[model samples]
Target: MPITTEPHVAAKPALTTTVAREYVHRAALSEVLLTGWNKTGRDAFKVTAQWPRSHSFYVSEHGMHDPLLLCETVRQASTLLAHVGYHVPLGNQLSWSRVQFAVNPYALRTEGTPADIQLHVTCSDIRHHRGMPVTMSMHMEAVRRDCLLAVASVRFGSHSPAVYQRLRAGKGDVNEVFAQAPQPPEPVSRSTVGRLRKQDIVLAPTPDRLRWQLRVDTSHPVLFDHALDHVPGMLMLEAIRQAGHAIEPARGGAVMPTSMDVSFNRYVEFDEPCWIEAEPVETAAPSSDGRRTIRVAALQSGLCAVNATAELTDTVSL
Candidate 1:
């Protein structure tokens, strides 16, 4: 089958329905954010998505869409492009290397209805194998009815089943590893993590006060929609979000993410405790709008598994 790259055109409303769950490697249709995509030029695409006003997992932060939702949208859009644009097989495994996203806080404000988004994505640094894409990075801007919502990037490796099996040698059985995943630890306070439910909190208190243990709940409908041998990237990303709130002084329980730049150095196994730590990067000199930067890391097996730097702000310009 050949995937065509036609010139860009206006998005069709009829294509607004969520795409197949498998296209983005998600288990549930609700987890799918992308509506559709059209190749605009070589390595360029236009992808459409929707952000519901109310979501159980990606809840609103002070009436604004969750920044991690933007990250998820970018992840899904990029993955979808990998499949339709580059013809990557659904059986292939995608190991994300990095995810970087920065959203315009003002643009995330929810109106009286759901938000429709259009992303202009361009891929680069592509590596091919046997005529199929092996790895690539996507840079895109998320727009909402002409308002720019976010700019993001995602880099991942596409591995065939054989290569993935070799990579996961011992943990190749996803179902077994998923079922064997450790029980989630007691979560931090809802107010502390800016979450309403204990299940949504991804951090457990530690003796150090500044550090927390990563909470992995395999039963999570959204995060663990479908299971795998290793801890998924999105879970680690949520850990960073909780840690950021834990590090900040609570004020009206409102702090939305402005940006997040993260890199995955190694896989976070389901069997170990990954320590999450956060430190302020720019505490003394805050931005005019009260934005602050924080550095967060996930450590496991005495090694850094993931690292991220993110910006936070309390105000959402409506």
Candidate 2:
């Protein structure tokens, strides 16, 4: 895929430490992007994050940060605010119901230093259970040196341990399901998915060009940072993004996912074969710059696991 490079900006000094890994549910501090945050008003805050110039994943051509990186950053910030700002119990599990992100291609740039980020976040549609917030929505703007990089939002719900346990109704539990999952099928060519590393490619070839078998790699360091009973929602988001790339005829990595609006309908199981399918969003108006749009769906057991509309652009919009 072709990517436009922006003028490099010098790094400015900022917070030096990341938040606790537990707050963001990350097993490694190396994966944490949030640096600090402070409450500004009721259900509002100012948060800071930093993106590394070089990461194992989350980068496109010319070192421009990938949009998925921003997605992950917002995901982390959401959990952090829930745990510390909202006082949700540490043991409670948070899951996103909806997630959307849009980026300006010009703002995805880097020199030799990390990108220092500032986000203004506000929460809404809060619903409480037992005097604690059980569900909420967050909207945030990601800025770098006064430049608007991206804007994103997430609607998520938090469930207590007991409630979460009851929600699991599959074969055995998550661990057993994960253990029984078949070996990951061979992935398509790294170049086909616009990935430099083979392990990062998440699609397996199928006879039908518009569809692919979802390749689940539970051992992947970043996506599967910790074990769970089901496939992580982020992984499904990624599968759709890749599906958009492959669904385009004659466009492999050429069709790159720049922005995505995803609604996770159900948990994607580990032991079953999940299919990623894509279709063009003909009703949706195209961007002035001629960006292609596609709706991708994850199908497991003939049911939609996720429904997402992804905007594709030739230039890097991460």
Candidate 3:
């Protein structure tokens, strides 16, 4: 995919130890989507960024900013707010409890456009204990050139480093879990996956109509950018997307996801065979525009690892 080399116009001064010391994420991981932030009030912040041609986690094969990246953006922005506004001791890990992504019909592609993006983040709820923020809720939007691209609602819980370490102690080595990369399975049909390329297909249908096996290629430059002990949450989201596409009729058109609500119940182990099962959720009435809702789950050892509900609409009539 092509990438733009133009620098972000609103890029802030390089992060320094003093500024990042209290950040929950460090180094490249700490690079917030926002170039700068202003405290609008006690519970609100105005954050801005010059949309970049590419991002480490946001870029996709189509050269557009993947919808999933907005989740991370909301995450970082939320943490930044907690640290800047509440004086919450930083360096605590945060894990998503619930996430909702609603894509605007006029979402912009970042491949070749230069646009200014702004986020207005408001803290909706904060559960505190012992003078520390234990959980937080935030609502934010990504607007480009006065057009809204997406809006996200997120709830997450903070975990201190010590607590996070203790929780992960028994997880064993992540590298070891990913050491054996499985070969790509037989490619599913383009009509079935809504993807033209085999490499992009994340689901391999099984005899059961509603069940499919998760397919992963560790060498995949984007999906498996680095060795991970468990399946990345983004891949699970992709699986949900693909599963929805497969079950929906193509006569209406290509599937365009409009909204998604996802919850991560547990880590999906890489060494185990993760199964994806999708079901159509009944709607009160048929959508005139060919929109449908799908509920998908990623299961391992018969236990749900992730649960997601996605709303998709046909892009064009066939």
Candidate 4:
């Protein structure tokens, strides 16, 4: 009889603390939403965090947590996966392709009591070419005391720092470009933006019902405590939410976002006139609870910068 040999498979290396340290930064604990994390599997992690009451980012004068904070939470959780076993390179610039986040409007408040937030994250849809990871996707669920607060789906790509630096160099110094004070638009009716206060309204209506202008006041204590070279991504997300509120009136007189899918095609610079346009996407009839979807786009220099689709529901008084 002829002898046959089988090929042997090599086992994956176990995760080590040293390797984790290279990707996880301690500074994020104070600056970002990350508080701590624990490895649960080869591609899964459990993250813990608490919303800050007075952080320069994401805090509102009303003491309510901004919906944008959920996006950051999802970003941090995805980064945590890089430490355990994902092939994320150190010092790489993380970019998003698509992000979808959904929240339970009734459980959106996070001001008075310190809510213990737990995030369960799983990394999947990893695509590699030439033995290098080109893209990956993550799914996360945020909970407080067993109550589902939010869920998110995010797709990310890693870019070399050299490429990012070279691209940004063409634009003026980042600090100088973003240092301009926010210019508030002429006062508009509160109902125009579905906001109760003038300070909270971020959109200025135009003659066209579907078109509005971006009104960013960098001087606002909560929205612009720090300066930058461009409009922050959070502001773009808020603009979409506010635009949805303006276009789609909630059946019960309160517009609460229940779901959102957003994609950023480019950055919106501060010096340019950014226009926001919103329209209703025909979908199945509104649910019994009055949930409906709106499509919004942020355009700069006649180019689309950010596109979003959001679902809103009436506020449920607790």
TM-score of each: 0.93, 0.89, 0.76, 0.75
Pairs that clash in candidate 2: 174-229
* Model 2 agreement with the true structure over 1-318: per-residue lDDT tens digits: 999999899998863788999999999889999999999998899999999987886765554577788889999999999999999988998988999999876687667788899999999999998899999999999999999999999999999988888887445666677777778999987666766677788999998888899999888999988777788887887787777766652232244456899998888887789998889877556566647888898999999989888988765322
TM-score of structure candidate 1: 0.93
- Stretches of model 3 off by over 4 angstroms after superposition: 1-34, 50-66, 79-91, 109-112, 178-187, 225-227, 249-253
Name the best candidate (by lDDT).
1
The best-first sequence of candidates by TM-score reads: 1, 2, 3, 4
TM-score of 3: 0.76
Instruction: Indicate which candidate wins on TM-score.
Output: 1
What's model 2's overall lDDT? 0.84
1-318: candidate 3 lDDT, tens digit per residue? 998797668967976222242342434433445566788877778776554566553444333455656655565577677787776666576677788889874464554654466888888688887888888888887887788888888888877877776876765665766786567577568779677667778888799888899987676655665566667666777788889888875564457667899998887766678899999999889888777899998899989989999998666621
Candidate 3: residue pairs that collide? none
In model 1, which runs have C-alpha deviations exceeding 4 angstroms?
1-15, 316-318
Candidate 4 lDDT, 1-318, residue by residue in tens: 998988888998964222232343323324555667777887787888766655554544333455667776676667666534565667666667788999875566655665567889887988875665668988889997898989998897776667667767766665676675457786447776566667767788789988899988676554553555567666787788788877866554556667889998987877788999999888766566777789999999999999989987655322
Error of 3 at 251 (Å): 4.7
Model 1 residue 262 lDDT?
95
lDDT of 1 by residue, 19-128 (tens): 88898989888788888889899889999998899889998767788888988888888778888889899999998899998888878888898899999999999999
Residue 100 displacement (Å), model 1: 0.8
Sort every candidate by lDDT, greatest first: 1, 2, 3, 4
